[model samples]
Target: MKLELLASFFLLTTCFTAFSQEKQDTAVADKGLIKVSVMYPYAEGKTFNMEYYVTKHMPMVAAFLGANLVKYTIEKGLASGIPNQPLPFMAIGTFYVKSLSDYQAAIAPHGDAIRADFQNYTNIIPIILVSEVVN
Candidate 1:
């Protein structure tokens, strides 16, 4: 049941992101900007320490990425589209970079350290997506 819910959430999120960007300018899409999205699916009894995520984890990651990262956004899920439905995801963290290679290289050295810090923030495993920003 948990796996099914997670799969459904991912499918919906991917469709939404793709469709939303469909009408965007192709010229803008020419920029080789890469977006790295980390999403945490919501589940009963899951725990997420938002305070630690925002104040500590994110900042540490940003520092590690340094100049490779152009910008980033953090979102906390509230309610789903259907009334009284559970939020599909607990939170999302997205970071943009001019070059995927640069971002990869930047994070490579600190990858282990980064993963190790997850325990302080949330118990749920994150879903990571790497894609070219089509506007």
Candidate 2:
């Protein structure tokens, strides 16, 4: 019947619309990107505390700084070609921020607090980088 065919058409259109909207929302969420690499040189016997800092303290600081934690990764290898030399641990934390200035301002006030909390873990040198989402 024509009525049944019309009903089917409407249902199909509605489903497609919902799917399209969901895709758009996901794309928006994926648009913002911020990356920070924290280089750490740990003292001997402080390796365990370094793990604790990454797991527990870093998240707290990231939250306090208003950063949405996207992902965290670690890579270990020789700092140079020397086999016996201990390479520094790199903690790479990715986040999503609205803008560069917004990200800067968010952490400006907490500089001292952040340093105090993280000083026990290791000597940290934070490198901040930003990128655009291209898909």
Candidate 3:
């Protein structure tokens, strides 16, 4: 009878431990990574200074973001998939961050400066997308 009680207690402790671990894992997964994409739609007669964007503007933004920024990518929009078609976007910039709230807090103070810097790079107003990177 004592041996059976000991085994049952062990099983109950193991189940509780597994349940606790599963809950912790779920909490962490809920706070997944985030991606911020800034895309410039292609437009006739619009101007984009790729040099200023890459060399000056992006670096400045990255500085503002500081440690919250996991990494970033810049893509020059090439020809569309269909032949003889104009590109959908002039350029695309993406930033991967661990936490959306952290990214937001990092950039909140520099919002105005960031927006004001746009004229130095592109005439087209950029479209911004914030999404969770679920993979």
For each candidate in turn, the TM-score is 0.75, 0.49, 0.74
Tens-digit lDDT track of model 1 for 1-135? 999999999999999888777745543654578889999999999999988999999989989888878888899999898998899999999998888888899999999999999999999999999998664
Tell how far residue 107 is off in model 2, in angstroms. Answer: 0.6
| Residue lDDT tens for model 3, 13-73 | 9999999999888556545668899999999999899999999998898888888787888
RMSD to the hidden true structure, all candidates: 13.2, 9.7, 11.7
lDDT of 2 at 23: 94
Residue pairs with backbone atoms closer than 3 Å in model 2 (clashes):
none
**Candidate 3 structure lDDT:** 0.89
Over 13-101, each residue of candidate 2 has an lDDT whose tens digit, in order, gives 99999999999986777665554555554345544354767677677666755544554455443364567666554444455555557
Clashing residue pairs in candidate 3 are: none
lDDT of each: 0.89, 0.62, 0.89
Residue-pair clashes per candidate: 0, 0, 0
Worst 10 residues of 1 by lDDT: 23-32
| Residue 45 C-alpha lDDT in model 1 | 98
